[model samples]
Target: MARCETCGNDYDRTFEVHMEGKTHTFDSFECAIYELAPRCAHCSVPIVGHGVQKDDVLFCCNHCATAVGVHELRDRA
Candidate 1:
């Protein structure tokens, strides 16, 4: 059994994920996404795709970036 770091719940069949040279365990996909997913800095929602990053904050989309007054980065080559 593994314990979830976020919810402090123990699970019989938990999934493990490695990120940033660290290991994280979760009981469900939702938990894993909640714990590991990149979140929007302004809305605080989980960012599924390539999120916009301005300065040190992350945004889910251009609307969110515009709403927060952060200049969104352009596409790469």
Candidate 2:
């Protein structure tokens, strides 16, 4: 049995996620992705897929990037 680090639940069927050399256990997929997922800079939404990047900032989509005035490269296209 493993303890979920995020929700502090003692789970017998928890899942593990390894990221940046750190291991985390979660009792459910919601806690796993919610606690470990990256969020968009503009809208604060969880970026599940490969998000749009500009410089060092991350956006959930091109519209968010453009809305934040960071997608200059995309605006030219």
Candidate 3:
């Protein structure tokens, strides 16, 4: 099983996506989209490189995640 680096979710399949002429693997469809979406803290352009996670906060990237400031919006337990 592969675990999402950002959300820490386990998944069965790993998707290979091309970005900036480089290929990256994601754990799920939603995770791939989150990485590709063009909404960041610094700009509206799509984010590249590794996803960002801080404490209980999650961001598409470090900049946006830091900018938007994520909170514990859900409780699994």
- The reply for model 3, stretches above 4 Å from the true place, is 40-77
lDDT of 1 by residue, 1-77 (tens): 88988787898988889999999988888888888899998899998789788878888887788787765465333
User: Evaluated with lDDT, which candidate comes out highest?
Assistant: 2
Estimate, for each residue in 21-75, the C-alpha lDDT of model 2 and write its tens digit. Answer: 9998999989987898899998999888888888788888888998878646452
Q: Rate the local accuracy (lDDT) of all candidates.
A: 0.82, 0.86, 0.59
* Candidates in order: C-alpha RMSD to true structure: 2.9, 2.6, 12.2
Q: Using Cα atoms with residue i matched to residue i, what is each candidate's TM-score against the true structure?
A: 0.75, 0.81, 0.39
Those runs of model 1 whose alpha carbons end farther than 4 Å from true positions after fitting are 71-77
TM-score of 1: 0.75
Enumerate residue pairs that collide in model 3: 41-64
Candidate 2: which pairs clash?
A: none
Q: Ten-residue segment with the worst summed lDDT in candidate 1?
A: 68-77
